[model samples]
Target: MTDSPLHVTVKLNAKLQPEHRHELFEDPLDALLESAELGQLTGGGTALTDEGEVDYGDIEIALTDPASLPGVIELLEQLGAPKGSLIQRAGEPDQPFGVTEGLALYLNGTDLPDEVYEQCDSNYVFEQIVERIEGVGEICSWWQGPTETALYLYGVSFETLRERIADLVATYPLCQGARVVKIA
Candidate 1:
């Protein structure tokens, strides 16, 4: 991995405006900064447009290492951001890193209105498999739909991630009726 800075473009959740970022993105952004090493949120923090709509959703951050891109995306997802974001060398769009390297699994089982909230602890289930994920993977960095808060994951390989999380998905009460679909 190069020590040269790279730009990571994060897609924010348009459902929320800049005013809500303090509670939604600030904490995680702060945590991410600890690892990303002083990257700033530029271009995406502007106020809402005159129509009261989100004018922009992508925030570009400078990273000290290209390898930390995935970690950055993972942290953003944990805070409920939209997915499908990308990273590239500071000035080279054609040279974006890992565009094809992203693989994901959506745990559409947790936080279901039908499931008991206490039992649907998405983070709890993650705790059970964090150690088992020997392969590269993470919760959604690029996801679809707004029907519900999607509990998705991104990984280097879908089969590996599915295998790693299968046990938890099969046995967890929260995972009942949950479909683990592979994201394109």
Candidate 2:
């Protein structure tokens, strides 16, 4: 496995928005590979659900390391994959973490103005989350939809991440009824 070119599909957390997921995971993933000398990130074309039918979040890196698999999983736990997360492209390994096994906080975007607001301001939901989750977690991805903004966080312990952001979820106007779902 070490000598041969192997396919590693590191299935991500399920709660993250399935669109453009590469942006959420690519930086850390590339750094890990480069620092560890694992392999290069050969870009993949547009991803699809069924034979290029839909817009799929696609990111590609190369490797086939049986020995390093456990270590890989450990490092990637920040992305919410505490268990084994990779699958062989050639189907060697049978199971991979589900695309749905992840966590996210959905904050209402209704009243939030487009203007920039202070960190703690209810209008600036992203900054508020970033400030509170200093070490607990990092927002990996976010989706600003018609109704709400889904903030996908990256962290080791789900409990800690929740604790760090609990106050905002409870008291803040925009986050008053925020939903934090941990699918893992």
Residues 1-184 of candidate 1 have per-residue lDDT tens digits of 5665666666443334355555556556866676547555544554345544333355557666667666776666665443343443346563222231223334553355663555467667667656666446554322233432334454556577778888877887766656666543
lDDT of 1: 0.53
Model 1, clash count? 9
Q: Number of backbone collisions per candidate, in order?
A: 9, 4
lDDT of each: 0.53, 0.58
Distance from true location, Cα of 53 in model 2, Å: 16
Candidate 2, 105-156: lDDT as tens digits: 8775565554422344543667887898776567766566667667776565
Note the residue pairs that clash in candidate 1: 83-141, 83-142, 84-141, 84-142, 103-155, 137-155, 138-154, 139-153, 140-152
Best by the TM-score measure: 2
TM for candidate 1 is 0.42
* Candidate 2 whole-model C-alpha lDDT, 0 to 1: 0.58
What TM-score, to 2 decimals, does candidate 2 have? 0.61
